[model samples]
Target: MAEDVQINWGKVKNIFESVTERMGQNPDRPAIGAPKAKVRVIKERLFEAKAEGHTFQIDEPVERGGNGLAPSPMAYFTAGAAACLTSHITQSAGFLETHYTSLEVEATVLWDNRRKFSIADLAQASLGIIYNIHMESDEPEDKLIALLKHAEDGCYASDVVRNETPLRAHLIVNGDEMYVHKNGAEIPDVPAGPTFGDNPTGMSKDEIAAKKRDGG
Candidate 1:
């Protein structure tokens, strides 16, 4: 029944109208600020970060002289990009009044540590972090593509990953460089098997099925 329910078209229209009118009249009134995070070193290769009352731990692996207690900082960075992109995709869907039975985003990082000889190489060696974003949604192909494009265009995390922001290394915070590298030879040309019934682009068989079963 939930999947069968239609989006509130009237509310969607009103929201668009109100947003446009407000932006046109007072463009400078709604100034959004970037989020900030503060971290304190707990011990060797371990730290605690606080952001908006939420606290989390960051640590390196046991092989890296850490206790292997919490996820490494790189894991958090990968997750943040995925989370931000998902948020943007959902926001775009809502703005367009699109309905879906389920939506999911997965991010994978390809890290090359060949040049990781010392801390000094962090800024240059770690520059080869590549992200693979895979999303699954039970929406039409056109709408889903549009949503993904909108998210990619506006997602702050993606922008940061794309190196669109300025960076500086300080004693307080370390500077890192990351760039996405695409190699056609390493990528598959097509899906290995038949497309999933729910997600045409990419999704496992266990993923959510389309609300309305359409021809695949």
Candidate 2:
């Protein structure tokens, strides 16, 4: 008698969970690429997040004193994961000799909490990216999947919060004026410090820009 072959999805999911979900960021607080300007999020996370006039939405959850006007941290986890997957596939596919057309990562974040946007008692129940590929090309499915595995291995943001990567950011303020970074580096070569709101705690954007110029 020939035995029936059945692929267990649970086992597959378990494997992904066991391996990728446990690998934390390579270097905690590693410097990642930042935008010179804000870029619009072309996609949304379960209608909780949306693109609006070229900005990634940031809002506190209902419990935290926000109007729930924005998506929560779990939502961000989903968004960042999907975004990383798309970017990784686009960049790594061709180099690995795979014909891939498009890819979209859809994540379902089920936070085990009554408090919205809270990480406490939270969970990511679903995670996977569907690749619309042109696998009819020379590369085999096994090889393409292997490349994807490798690329996912390098995605840090997805692993950062999930694996609890160590991070910290210190601030130095003067009279409600936010301080710029000073590492004894040359002008135009120095890294940018954190940015603040238009009318932040103290100085206006212009005042802050001027302060940067004066090395204040």
For model 2, what is the alpha-carbon lDDT of residue 144?
Answer: 76
lDDT of 2 by residue, 1-216 (tens): 223323333443443444333333333432333334332333342133334225455555667655566776556666766777656554455445554433445545443343444544444423334333232335676887787786677665555545534433335466564645453333232245643211223455698789779865
Residue-pair clash count for candidate 1: 0
Models 1 onward score TM values of 0.61, 0.42
Shift in Å, residue 162, candidate 2: 5.2
- Per-residue alpha-carbon lDDT of model 1 for 58-155, expressed as tens digits? 99999988999999998898888778886766666677766454555667766547557553544444443344545444778888778678767878
Q: Which candidate is the best by TM-score?
A: 1
lDDT value, residue 180 of candidate 2: 55
Output the TM-score of candidate 1: 0.61
Error of 2 at 146 (Å): 0.6
